[model samples]
Target: MIEAHALIKRYGDRRAVDELSFIVKPGQVTGFLGPNGAGKSTTMRMIVGLDRPTAGTVTVAGRPYREHTAPLCQVGALLEATAVHRGRTARNHLLALAQTHGISSRRVDEVLGLVGLADVARRRAGGFSLGMGQRLGIAAALLGDPAVVILDEPVNGLDPDGVRWLRDLLKGLATEGRTVLVSSHLMSEMAVTAEHLVIIGRGRLLADTTVSDLIDRVGVGSVLVRSPNGADLRDLLVRHGAEVTGVEPGLFQAAGLDAATIGDLALAGGLAVHELTPRRASLEDAYLELTREAVEYR
Candidate 1:
């Protein structure tokens, strides 16, 4: 598991991270979410020991990342997919990392194949496309088979198929009991991939909650109603404090009330109800609501 206790990072007068604290448990995927300039990259850098925190502590598997004898084996990260040397082949790059950790050529080959880069193992990283670069970076991260995995914007350049493949790969890692933390802007993908979320804004912790709970907290979904007497039903619902909007001759949307209550009201009002369905708020809807005030880029 990964833990952060009152983490803080500052640059001159501006604080990049401030008193942030959270835990990323194993056996599940935790999503790091924030708007631009929300200090997500800064936090990830601190977690991997790339940036020094001004105060507080962050540890992976019970210790700081730098304290580990073999840090790569303790935590695998892909903070920047394009950080690789432009001149080196994908295989050789991973081979160099593997060599440092006493990992074998066989394991390098295994990770290369695992990331679907086996065919282009000899190709130089400079020639690889954005998607291919991401794959190669992922291959390097898995080379050590670490217990904790952290990735920043992993799906930045991936296509639909690659995105799905990455989703499965991360899920598989969590299935193996690895602590997985990934940061991404794609809410639709994060909705299905991450079980828990750590949301921050302006360098401070905003929420730490599960996907379902987050949705439920801000999810006041509207109700769709179909009735033969739409006008009469709308009037009755308005009387009961429902903000009703007409969709057509026989269909309408109702808010400030639920389906069951609307159904009961319609029944009492002698309205023929044809359908009463509640549209649950989606992850995107909830995220926008929670982060509305936190968005830095507008």
Candidate 2:
């Protein structure tokens, strides 16, 4: 688990992170979301002790990252996949990190295979493609089998297949009761992979809720109803206090009423209903609505 209390970070006069606090628990994937310049990178850096917090504290598995005897075994992070040395092979890069913590060569090979980098293990990292480089970074992250995993844009250079593989890998890690906190702008993927979310805007905590709860809070969902008697249905729905809009000659959308309620109302009005489907807001929709005021980069 990872915990942050009133965390603050400042660069000269500007505050990058301001009084942020959130708890990321084990056994589930938590998504860290925000618009550009929302202090997400700064916050992630602070979590792993890449940057010191001006105030407050952040701990991984009950203590600050520096206090752990085997820091890599407690938390593994991929803040910058391109930070590796260009002269080293993918296997050499991981082997170097493994040696720092006394991790075995056998385990290094295991992670290489786990990340599908065994084929390119002997290849120099500088010559690797963007996707291959990302795979190597992930290999280093899982090298210690840490209890907590932190990744920032892990799918940045991945193809569709790699994206799918990463989604499965993150879910699998969380299933093992590891505390997984991933930052990504891909709302659709997060909606499927993450059970909970910690949203920040301008370095402040905006929301810490589940994916379903966040969508329900926006409450922008509507029910689409199709019928031959569209006009009549629209009038009836409006009279029943539902905000109705015509989509076409035979279809309408209704808000402030659920599908079941609309179906019952249409049935009571003796109207023939061809279709009634609920259209809840997507994760992207909710994210935009919530961070509308918090966006700094427009």
Candidate 3:
């Protein structure tokens, strides 16, 4: 479990993260999502003690990361790339980390195998591809067999297969009762991977709820309908106390009315329907709607 209380970070007058607080529960994948420069990275840095918080505090397993006797073993972090000595192998990097925590070399090999880096255990990290580097980073994170995992933009720069692998791995960790905190710009991927989300903007909390709750908070999403009898349908929907918008020449967007009601109205009034569908309500739209007033820079 991870917790942040009134976490705040500032550089001069610019507030990178302000009064942000949230909890990451075990057995769930919690997503940290926001636009570019939304303080996701800064907050993560503060959490793991990579950067100190200006005002507030963050705890991993009820203690700050720096205070832990064996910090790596208590919290596994992949905040940086794996750039070991060009001559040293991947296994050596992990072994060195294991040595720092007084862990055995057997655990190093276990994590190497777990992250599918056993074959390249002898390969120099400098020669590894980006995907391989990411895997090695993951192997290092798992080296301590930590109970809580925090990843910032884990899928960034990764290929499709690697992205899916990371997603599945995070999901698997959460399923096994490990707390997972993943920060990403990929909302669509987050939609599939994260059970709960903490949305922020301009260094403030916009939302802290389940994915479905955030979607529902978009004030009952509507569908875009295009009908030859657009005006007629709009009038009918208006009469039924529904919000209707004439978006184009022959297209109208309707809310407060379901498809069945619209269909029954058109059928009873002899109005021909051209097209109707339950539109996909994107998380981006929901986020934009919620953070429209919270954004600091336009």
Candidate 4:
């Protein structure tokens, strides 16, 4: 599990992360979402002890990452796929990381195969493609078999199949009772992969919620009611405090009311209802509405 309390990070005149607090639980995948330069990468760096928090505390498994005896065994992070030695082979990269923590060479080969980098394991990382580089970075992360996994844009350069593989891989890690925190700009992928979300903007915590709860809280959904008695239905619905608008001659859009309530009101007024379809808001819609003001770059 990852716990951060009022975490703050400053760089001279700029406060990149400001008083951000959120808990990432184990046994589930948590998405870390934000706009460009929303301090997501900064926060993730602090979680792994690569950067220090200017104020507040963030701990991995009840202790700061640097304080752990074997940090690699406690947390596996893939912050930058390209932050490797250019001349080193993919296999050497993992081997180098494993050597730091005294991990067996067999484990090194295992992770290489696990990430599907075994075929080109001997190739220099400098010549690898973007997708291949990402795979190598992931292999290094899993080398220690940490209890917590933190990945920043793991699917940055992956193809569709690679993206699907990453989704399943993260889910499998969480199912094993490990804390999985992932950051991505792809909202659609996140909607399917993450059970919970921690969204931030302008270095502040905007939302920490489950996917279902976030959708419900946004509540911008509208119910489309089609009827022969469209005029009468609209009148009755407006009387009940519903905002109604005629999309066309026979179709009406009702806001601030659910489908069941609208249908009930139509029935009581003796209106012939044809269709009562609810147009629910998507995650992208909710995210934009929630973080509209917090967006720094527009």
Candidate 5:
């Protein structure tokens, strides 16, 4: 598990992360979400001890990342996929990382196959494609079978097939009871991959909640009603405190009311209800609502 309590990071007069606290528990994938300059990368760096916190503390499996007996074995991270030695082969890079913690050559080969880079294991990393480079970074992260995994935009350069594979792999890791914290700007993928979310903006915590809860908090959603007696239904709905907007002659969008209520009103008004569809708020909608004001740099 990963616990961050009142974490803060600063560079000169600017604060990148400010008193952020969130727990990334085991057995689930927690998505770390924010805008481009929301300090997500800075926070991730602090978690792995790559950058020092200006205040507060963060721990992986109960201790600071640097304090662990074998840091790599405890927490595996992919901060930058392309930050590798240009001279080394993919296999050699993983082998070198394993050597730091006395990890075996067998584990190196295992992770290479696990990430679908076995075919290019002997090729120089600099010559690999973007997707291939990402695979190698993930391979290094899994070399020790670490208890905690932190990946920043793991699917940035992946193709559709590679993206699907990564989704399955992350879910599998969480199922194995490892703490998985993934940072991504892809809302569609996060909606399907993450059970929980940690959303921040302008270096402040905006939300730390489940996907369903976040959607609910944003608002149940507006209801779409298509009726033959649209005129009467609109007046009836407006009188009932619903904010209704006409999409066309026969279709209207009703907010501050549910489908059941709208349908009942239409039926009571002798209106022919053609359709009463409740469009639930999506993750994208909720995210935009929460972060609209908090966004920095426009």
Candidate 6:
């Protein structure tokens, strides 16, 4: 498990991460979300002890990463970019990492194979394409076989197939009861991949909730009605204490009434109804609602 209590990071005059606090439990993938320049990198840097927090503390498995023996074996991370030396082969880089924790060479080959980089294990990393570099970086992160996995923008620059592969891999890792904390700006991907969300803006916490909860909070309830007599139906629904809105010129959105009840009302009122569809709130809409004012740039 990873827990942060009032974490703060400052640079010169700016507060990069402002008293951000959240707990990421094992057995699930928690998505870390924020806009550009929202202190995401800084926060991750602090978590791994690469940057000391200005205030507060963050612990992985009940200890700060820097305080742990075999830090790599306890926590694995991929920051902004894969920092592999251009001259070395993929196999050599992973071997180097594994060796740091006194891990065996066999583990090196195992991770390389697991990340599907075994075919190019001997190829120069400098010659690798962006996607290949990402795969190699992921291979290195897994070298320690750490209990906590932290990835910053893991799918950036990946092809469609590569993106899907990473999604599956992250999910599978969580199934093994590992703590997976991922920072990403990809809302659509997060909507599908993340079970919980930790949202930040301007280095401050904005939300920490399940994806479904956020959706429900913003979605509330809305009814989609297709009928020629929309005007009449709107008046009736409004009179009955239903909140109404216009989705389009003709179609009306209704709240406080179920489809079945709406249909019965329409029939009793002798209205020509063509369709009635309900739209539950979506994660994208909920995220926007929560972070709309938190965005730094237009």
Clashing pairs in 6: none
Q: What's the TM for model 2?
A: 0.87
- lDDT for position 251 in model 5: 94
> Which digits, one per residue and each the tens of the lDDT, describe model 3 over residues 166-233?
88999999999998898887878998999999988988888899988888776446767777888888
Full ranking by TM-score: 1, 5, 2, 6, 4, 3
Q: Residue-wise lDDT of candidate 4 within 54-151, one digit each (tens)?
A: 99999999999999999989999999999999999988888888888999999999998998888998999999989988888888888899999999
lDDT of 1: 0.93
- Lowest lDDT 10-residue stretch of candidate 3: 79-88
- Candidate-wise lDDT, in order: 0.93, 0.93, 0.85, 0.92, 0.92, 0.88
Clashing pairs in 1: none
Where model 1 places Cα greater than 4 Å from the true spot, the runs are 227-256, 260-273
Please give the lDDT score for candidate 2: 0.93
Badly placed stretches (over 4 Å) of model 3 are 82-87, 219-271, 294-298
Write out the backbone clash pairs for model 5. Answer: none
Report per-prediction Cα RMSD to one decimal: 2.6, 3.1, 3.8, 3.5, 2.7, 3.6
lDDT of 2 at 84: 92
Residue 294's lDDT within candidate 2 is 97
Backbone collision tally, model 6: 0
TM-score of 3: 0.84
What does candidate 5's lDDT look like per residue over 51-114, in tens digits? 9999999998889999999988899999999999999999999888898899999999999999
Q: Which is superior by lDDT, 1 or 6?
A: 1
lDDT at residue 143 of model 6 (Cα atoms): 81
Candidate 5 stretches with Cα past 4 Å from truth are 229-257, 260-272
lDDT of 6 by residue, 1-298 (tens): 9999999988889999998999999999999988888888888998899999999999999989989999888898989555888899988988788877899989889988887788999999989888888888887778889999999998987999988999999999999999999988788899889999999989999999999988888654678998899899888888888888987756889988888888988889998889888888777778778888888887
